[model samples]
Target: MIKNGEEKPTTNPVTAPYRYEISAEQCRSCDRCKKACKAGAIRGERGQAAYLIDEEK
Candidate 1:
């Protein structure tokens, strides 16, 4: 695509990255994953709440 006097390069773009998700009652809440996640996408409620990835983050 071109705009003004510049052209955007679309040779290589993100197609479909991994849609990571954890099923309900799947996470053991071991806190191991929380430590591993650098993006801090993993989130959950208190106690044994099921953890879900915050993709917006």
Candidate 2:
């Protein structure tokens, strides 16, 4: 396949059938993880139990 005006390799990358997730009930609302995320893919707020990761990222 062509990408960025360049041809890509014929090899296919491996992908997992499952994804990691943290339940809202399991979340303690700690800001540590959010702070550690440099890509800003993690969406959540401190003091709030709900959290989610952006699949696009």
Give the CA lDDT, 0 to 100, for residue 10 in model 1.
45
Models, CA RMSD each: 5.7, 5.2
Off by over 4 Å in 1: 1-14
Model number with the top TM-score:
1
Itemize residue pairs with steric clashes in candidate 2. Answer: none
lDDT (Cα, 0-100) at 32 in candidate 1: 67
Name the lDDT of candidate 2. Answer: 0.71
C-alpha lDDT score of every prediction, in listed order: 0.71, 0.71
State, as a TM-score between 0 and 1, how close model 1 is to the true structure: 0.57
- For residues 1-57, write the lDDT of model 1, one tens digit per residue: 323435644444556777887766577776667667899998765467777788887
TM-scores of the models, in the order given: 0.57, 0.56
